[model samples]
Target: MIALPFLKSVAPPLQGKRIYLRPPTLSDYRAWASLRAESREFLAPWEPLWAVDDLERGAFRHRIRHYDDEAAAGTAHPFFLFRNTDQRLLGGITLGNIRRGVGQNGMIGYWIGAPFAGQGFMHEALSLLIPYAFTKVRLHRLEAACIPSNERSIRLLEKAGFQREGLLRSYLKINGMWQDHLLFALIEDDARAGK
Candidate 1:
């Protein structure tokens, strides 16, 4: 296990009405891998192609270590969403590329399990996460980018108060192809406006 000297300074688990967000743990490998496997087809178009060992336990441990390091360094906060009632893993969200001082900004990314998609859980999770990001993480701006063809993600970001800012040409590589993406952003003021 990696030691996180700044663990206490990191944002705590966020609790919401229907879901809660916490960091991924070693014990989560089985469920995480299973869900990813089942959702592979549903998620492929929106994500980078997975490596052959992506779901292996060793990979998961490495991921956990990386997450801890990022969190400790105050560069990112990675969380796994769970249903509040049963604690079933539903999805994940990450506030990555966190920048402080003059910027006070971060990029948000997320993915939901196929079985839990379209059920308002991710929406709820975002509701909880946004507040935490602004207040607890002390972030002024949060940004997200999604493939223009991904209507679901676009809608989700809009619903979560992210305004469509613009488009990027060949912004990122997804599923082994470079793709254009729509950029969305939310500032602290925007969230305060209840957008």
Candidate 2:
């Protein structure tokens, strides 16, 4: 198995009141695979179609390499959420598609295992991540897009202080189809004002 902590020295783990966020590691394959397999039906609607080997160990290694490459390139940050008390993986969140220079922005995407849904974990994780995006990453703006039918995601982003901007027709290919998404955004100043 691959070792742990390739990202520790780079970004380190972020801790909140009830949970923490850290970069995924090779040692996480089994738990990650198991949770994703079990939650496949629950998560598939909002995500890209999975490859035939999506949960296999080799695919996991490729996934890690992709994440590591993005981290190195400053294009994305992917974190897995773990409960503080038990360290159980509950979900994952990503601040990706980053643009610096004049843009100074990043996009957010996330998912929670079906078993852990509606437990306040994502709320806390979003709380932790917004600050990380604004302060630690020094990003000027963060954005999230969700299918209009994804009421839960809409609520989560709004509760985290994201303001709806507009809708993009066929913005992302989800579940193998081009789907419309409502766009939301939060700026650094807005984040500070909300605090």
Candidate 3:
């Protein structure tokens, strides 16, 4: 959860061959707004119900503040995906709900604009993010949960080496209704072993 006049100290970007992941800034409002608005119908089924002012500039600024606060507190990291060639915002991913000390883990959440779906951008992002989660963030486990009907996400997680754990009944609210999710996890040991 974050946005715009750009964050004062932009986080270092995680680079990939075709994409990069960096924090979203004020400069991204137009592209982000257009993409989300255009893909509203496509995203609505999977995302939480949007607020009446979800796309407003003020809301985005507030989101960025929250993101910065979380990051500074070591609780979450949020990033926007961009194309290497053009820097177009493809989507966003975040490692949230980080638990430290005895529970060194975090939850991953992501979204790709409809136009960029099925093109492997997210896979590339995860390839970069997972290692960072383990080595840089020093996390022991990474978790992801997707709506039961989101076959694309299910496949993506599996392909990224996450093992299916189980189902979470009424795990989250999506589009105004409670929905179940399939829980998946990837542990540091398995990742280091090249799983």
lDDT scores for all predictions? 0.90, 0.90, 0.90
Point out where model 3 deviates above 4 Å.
1-10
Summarize candidate 1's per-residue lDDT along 1-195 as a digit string, tens digits: 875443343568889988999998899999999999999999999999999999899999999999988988889999999988899998899989988779989999999999999998888988988998887787899999999989999999999999999999999999999999999999999899897
Decoy 2 TM-score against native:
0.94
Tell me the tens digit of each residue's lDDT in model 2 across 45-67. 99999999999999999999999
Where model 1 places Cα greater than 4 Å from the true spot, the runs are: 1-10
Model 3, residue 2: what's the lDDT?
A: 68
lDDT of 1 at 115: 92
State, as a TM-score between 0 and 1, how close model 3 is to the true structure: 0.94
Clashing pairs in 3: 2-63, 2-64, 3-64, 4-25, 4-26, 5-26, 6-26
Structural similarity to truth (TM-score) of each candidate: 0.94, 0.94, 0.94
Q: Compose the digit string of candidate 3's lDDT tens values, residues 1-195.
A: 663221233457999999999988788889899999988988999999999999999988888889888887778889999999998999999988988879999999999999999999999999989998887788899999999889999999999999999999999999999999999999999999988
Locate the minimum summed-lDDT window of 10 residues in model 1: 2-11
